[model samples]
Target chain A: MNRRCSLITILATAAALFTGCEREEIRVYSVAKETAEAPAKAASDTPTPAANAPRPQLAYTLPAGWQDAGPTPMSLANFRITTDAGEASVNITPLASMAGKEALVVNMWREQVGQKPLAEGELAGALAPIEIGGEKGQLFEIAGSRDGQTVRIITAFLHRGGASWFYKLQGADAVLTAQKPVFVEFLKTVRIKEPGSAPAAEVVKVADPAPAATAEFKWKVPEGWQTLPAGQMQVAKFAVPARDGAKAEVFVSVFPSDTGGALANVNRWRRQLGLEAVDEAGLKALVTPLEGAPGAMLVDLKSDAKAMLGAIVPREGRWWFYKLMGDTAAVTAERAAFIRFVQTAP
Target chain B: MKLLWKFFTSLRLTVWTLGFAIALVFLGTLAQVHEGLWDGQTRWFRSYFVLRKAGDVWWVPPVFPGGYFIGAVLLLNLLAAHLKRFQLTWRKAGINLTHFGILLMLVGGLATDMYSRESVMNLREGGTRFFSEATREHELVFIRTLDDAREEVVAIPTALLRTGAEVRDAKLPFPVKVKSYWVNSTPDFRAPMGKNAAPLSDKGIAKDWDFSERPETKGMDDRNLPTAILDLGEHGVWVVPSWASDELLIESVKRTYTKSVGAETAAGMAAKMAAPQEVEAGGRKWRMTLRPTRHYNSFSLTLLKTTHEIYLGTSTSTNPQGIPKNFQSRVRINNPTKGETREVDIYMNNPLRYEGLTFFQATMGRDEIVDVGRSGLQVVRNPSWLVPYLSCLLVGIGLTVQFLYHLIGFITKRRATVAV
Candidate 1:
């Protein structure tokens, strides 16, 4: 190839890269956030109470033959009732807000039972007003077939304290129909108490799922520590080089909250080491606050042959656990370094 | 110049480049087991050099020539050899055409890799959407609500959202200080605050939930939920996680609106306004969210219906769930600018191509809790989609012509020998 031709080929290749590559750029645009006009108008017309109104304590009386199944992760209150027809379940869940998309929620239940989503125009007629906690609430009843069986779902929701509470009763069609009257009566019995007031039945507080946020944790690793693949529930793992024919492993793990608290975790580690579990007073004497790391507690537990040096630190609504476990000699050798590692971590 | 020309046209160089390509493919395929398909393809095939990450550190160094390097060398070698043996005669036509075809394919592949983008659009029955979301990319967007139901949005791509970086733009009122960014995360609802549990944020669901980073999942069905913390200075630090719904934050912000209402009528009006979370900055109400990167189009698609078929007699005593046979989504396309309106069905093996975009029915399911049929459409845009077909056609034609030329010459030689 001539020199000119070769130059052209090189230029063409470079040009291809520039032409094909999609540049990542900041975009500014004006877009219509909402597409449906009907739903937005309907939401505006819906009666919403004052947002700053004092939130009332909610308590409910259970219907006869209904067993309290206790609160679940998703539901604040759960109850079960069984009959010859089929078992029915009742649960109360709270959503911060639905943003006036109650029709969407109702349509979700409809689709669950193999029914189509309800149109916005038909949403008002589909919902029946009922009393809940002495306030007006809307009730939706949907019936459909699922897996060749007729199923029914009855959901009643009320807005309070800038949130929506949904009380849903779902079961087979025949069972739900039989319990419809009883369900209404149960709804009528729901009463609001003054702030911090206790009633005959206490509403169970359910834990909301907290998404784990990543925060940078910085610590200097001691020399001779070989990095190992972290196992499930662990953030980091390292193997200390063998010394005196004994080896120790370092594990760093974190949890959303204090995993069973410091005493329980310490006792569990003690049990693993075949040592007697200690009480709160014993735990207080055993664990010392890690130096330079505020709110971090360090504990040293040693058995006849096995030993564990652990630290528990709480930060940002999460608990960080660092442990050095293995042979007694190895754990003792690594204890100082392990304490330093935990102290330097954020 | 002569030495370089000889080197470029060397058969030895061509053989080595081809050998490296084979090795690149083999190694890249194997690397997918550890790095995943997307990451492996990017590192081994798209890049010019194969880079190896240092143990437990961010340092990565090039270890060997990657696919792009080998491809470029092979392209140059072919061009040199073709030019060196160039002839206008019909006998050389087949060889020249084959070389040109390969060159076209190489260029096309590079073009496709750079320009083509894949995204997904999820629509419920009777739902309409004008934008598709990228599967892997994410963006932090600040939106200001305007009159007439419109919103002015300023989006920052994930590449610019590094931890500790203060991102500033002309459109932004305040510099956004990124505290942390998690590539993949999980929510722990059982956040029991310890005695020294310092609050991460005063706004949003982060006040109640704790988030932690997890290893990125490679499964096709799984997606990484990224979380970020932004220090908005006087506006307060906010923890943002990629939640399916933004109602929690919207409600939290609205709760503050209730306190501002002085009159009874104003309180009633404020109560009815279920507005999004808005921060007052630069005399504008800004709402921020970390969400999937979106590619908006002028046209819109509304899902009319979704049909999920199951194999007959698949549900038995042993198998409670029936086997899925096929899924189809009926969608209506509406483009006001072009004045185009049409309805089409997208199903397995049958994709709908409209206006340079192809939509394939990827998955179909119903949300049990929400009672809505969902259809996931895989949207792909490739300008060079036809290049591979044309390249293969040219090669096939060239090979056939070359075979015919030799076959005719052999037949003629046999005839002349018989005549002698």
Candidate 2:
């Protein structure tokens, strides 16, 4: 009996230990929130420039035969010169605090043109000295082959006011060579001015020009709705007065393309109301055709406390999004009016 | 029963187990060339069987007894042998001590393997962290900010996350249903999305980007970027990827609104916008992220400074930037329970061991543009770290006692002969 009891105890203990070896369960815990801390003062001996220093403006004369290509994502000012040989482009870009990494910057341009990167020791030997805006700078002329054709690049960079400005002209060898002298003369005409200075004619301002709306659609404003100025990316805006301390707004926005499709747009509206997103099939089930508008679908999403009423209308190669978002009660009150308002012609 | 006892207590079992151990080590080392150290160790040493995939299929069969099997056998063999031959005598004391020491070591090894934890803490200068994250494993976390200083977090381990798995907890307002789980995925920002693009998550950053599945990374320096499409019944489907940078994504969205509203209002509305990896339900905001599994601690470490130094004027042909000679982190430890707030410096060789954990300086990097320095510390917790030392001491004492006893007996016998 004793031996049998001992065996049973051993097996039971073994089973208990094995059972305890299962994977950990889901855990819930409260932790102190992470608060951002200010970075410690830099220990370097040299004074580091502040990132948000006062802005400076650059004014330059546009060379003849060169047309302003407008601003690009990579450059603040862009100009193009077209000839029989090929088109050459000039770009002026400003970067903050490139003080000690000049060689790194030059190497990046070299790599762009299929040229080998130069070491910091070899940088000075490869670059020639030039003057830009009365300030000394380095000019790099690199010629490399791309797609069995010779490509030439002429770039000059200067450091001033804790910012590095690069003026680069690149194109087919023949075109770039022809425009090189003109680019150099244009660089000499560049001048940096402090902010709040009087503007010169043809001087490009340093600001992102908001895209002009291609087309406008008239909407029948409901009673008790207040008119407000449209914000960026919005064509028109209307505010609904606060009811029970809850405010709602209607925004009419247009995008160049289908902004990630109708499903994405409906989900974006749904997400605003703390509601779960639905798939394409689910979206179709929830979408209702606008009464007077053809090929337009309206979505109404409501959560416990919040709601959003939106419409996706496609017209004239653009997508129009109409959204009315606010407290659930307010949205519920305006659901019919919101749908009727979206049914207006584009 | 008698035959079983004989077999377990036999010396032949010991020899065979040791031979298998040597073979296991050899195979594991060779596997590391392709499988990496961590994975190889897990496959060969941490398991009981060496499993082989049955010809490119999911079926894996045990082909050989692995390290754990051999170790357990050897342990049982030693224990049984000691039990069978146990005798309390001065003459046999040394042998018994030596056997017990080896037994203790084997048990300690198993303990360490089962209980040890390795994690990492990354902190920028003046940043404080109360938890260390697992080096490789990931967890899905839903964090609700209760206030400016406190947050309620519910974390689900990735092991429990599988396709078609619905995870529910009392603390969760809704069930987290996983639609698809990718162990490794790469995001493409420029991929054109047509009407027929794969149906990804309906919300979050994944809607703006396309993700492609990739093979799991096995390199020592590489990590798998996991992505999961999760559905919360009525709340919405969200794509949570490990590679999403919440700060950068939120800042970009805030910048768009800041152009219209003032900077202050935009900053306040950052969480209000459809921020990536964020969801809202029950009038509460929850930020979801698939990140390295975190191990919270009772105390916190605040990074005060990071010092990186290199030998002056020393540059090699391969390294234009001089090789780092030293990396140090100055950290302040805060333990509210003990009312202890003290600063300590951890460097390459010197580590800070406190509260059953050891913090070693692992890596340091600096962002020259932002002038922010970050430090990574390897946190290791092993309760049996001193077991090897204690075992070695016992073995030394046992062998010394054995050798001295024989020497004394031999000398005394010789002296007796000389006197006679």
Candidate 3:
């Protein structure tokens, strides 16, 4: 009886030890279903009246020969300025109630230029006081080399209207140096339009610009091709007829030559046609000279069902593209004609 | 039999095992710089024998005894010593209790190592979450949305994503075949006309970018993002790692669909808008995307606000360096099944222990552009989490009582000797 009782006790203890802790059951719910069923309750209850308030207007004048790229997600305003050397970009961003400080911002920009962050005492020497929008602002110019290429940056910071507005222009050293005066002039025109205030008549209206003159490039159209008016960022557009009744498109556009370099652009075009990208040697072998335009390169690639013909023309620090893409058969037949059109483009 | 009993209750064995444990901890701490925290723990603490790579070679040879081995030996020694040498008396009760507590701790540690789960829940300001994602594991989730406002989910853990393996479930309409899997990969863009290019597997964004195998990350802050290329027989899909932001997934879907549908015309491609991908599977329309593996909970938490404050002078020129002083999250927990709702403030060192889980403030940051705060809460569920606390208390009481008893006995003996 004693042995049996001891055995029973051991077994009971083992059972209790193993069964002491229980695993909790996991419950799964459809968040999407719940949200769709009760949108009002499912949404956050935090009141954000300030989020719905009307934003203050920011006004600025465009420098001569500068084109506006409109607003981007991170920038309040973006402009592309073309110079003889290259194209430079000017971006204005307003950070409202940001936790960031001036020293941090300056140091971040310094790091971008491959320079060490300045000490507190060195900041005063690095920054120059400038007048912007009738307010005192700080301007900084930094020049450095990135990947064997000389790059320059001009940055300005203005504290006004409960926000820190940053204006930065970056490009090749030569082009940035040339556009420094224009950037300074542009900064002087910055103004903050108060809420519910109308702009004075003398102020340049933010409305769309008047229709511009026709683009300078001209080319002969092939037979059965329809010429369409060019849209934003395009010099010309043509609809070419494909044998399969599907319409192919041809576009003529120009951008800064430093935009991702020639190899990257070629690879981008190749990716669109479902072709594999090539190395620099392969790209050089594939590129043929344009007959009419000297120093211009043409690339013709054909895939299973699609084909792309493009010409990269270098002129005055700008790279012009004359591209035609369509069904394989159509593009093959029109290859010579597209090349001729690109050769004739001036 | 006498010799074997003596060996089992030997204090020498305890000392040796403890020495091995100390060596294991020191080596494990050094290994963390190269192997990362999770790998180090698995290699040293969780295994029976700690192994070290034979000089840069792939072979791992046993170098030292591991935590489990030492712990098991120590537990046996304690039990044997107590059963054979300890006397059952009021004076010895404290010693017995202390030994018992240590034994409980050893067993509890083993159980916790096997059963504990850790995950992280990220919440933006005003965001709600009912699930937390696993930190070190990946899962392929197949969700079927029913018409009755319900969902049936099938999650396949990363262990099953082997090449040529077919995973099937009773509720799944078809089996999924794993074509390829990579624990760590670097994204490589293919050259359009380059020779010896990798073949495109699926008709998705992966065709444009190839993932090449890479060495695993080795740090506490970095993690390996496993990528898998799965074949659904007629259809194929590439599963890539998801970032904290869902916008990347949406943008990838948009770009992939635009290219696939022959919408690569400059105009059409430029006008593409972000959208989620939905596919009809198992007679139900399901939204499909590769996301972090989630552990669903019975309760839901909504973050009302998150605040991160830096030291007052850190923003000035005097300091010029931002040092975070405090990070906090105001959250409301709702358990619909239990009909319990409560608001809790979780901050550093002050975690909320509810429903057998502990939520601790792990990370906090602010989105500069959007001016919104984000918070990361680490959720830990360990059944034996209280074992160490109980052990410490028991040991403290036991030592105090034993010390007092010894003192009293010494004084009484001295007085008796003087009187004699």
Local accuracy of candidate 1 as per-residue lDDT tens digits, B384-406 = 99999999888888787778878
Candidate 3 CAPRI classification by DockQ: incorrect
Candidate 2 wrongly placed segments (more than 4 Å): A1-22, A40-346, B54-62, B190-199, B245-274
Per-candidate Cα lDDT values, in order, are 0.73, 0.74, 0.67
User: Lowest summed-lDDT stretch of 10 residues in model 3 chain A?
Assistant: A36-45
Task: Evaluate model 2 with DockQ and give the value.
Answer: 0.13
Model 3 Cα shift for residue B186 (angstroms): 3.4
Candidate 1 Cα errors over 4 Å, as ranges: A11-20, A35-54, A57-346, B55-62, B189-196, B244-276
lDDT of 1 at B30: 80
Candidate 1 chain A: minimum summed lDDT over ten consecutive residues — where?
A205-214
- What lDDT tens digits, residue by residue, belong to model 2 across residues A281-333? 99889998876666888887878777888898887666678899888777777
How do the residues A1-346 of candidate 3 rate in per-residue lDDT, one tens digit apiece? Answer: 2434433443454454445453422223454443411112211122222323455566776654567776643355777766556777888765543233666667766665577898988877888988788789888888765445566788888877566677888876777865787688778888876578886234332222212225454556888788887654456788887676755788877665434566877898999987889999989988988876878888888788788888898776566788898887778778878887777746
Better of 2 and 3 by DockQ: 2
- Ranking according to lDDT, highest score first: 2, 1, 3
Expressed as tens digits, the lDDT of each residue in B255-369 for candidate 2 is: 6644433344344344332234677788898889888899999999999989989998777778866888999999999999899999999999899999999999998997432
What TM-score between 0 and 1 does chain B of candidate 3 receive? 0.85
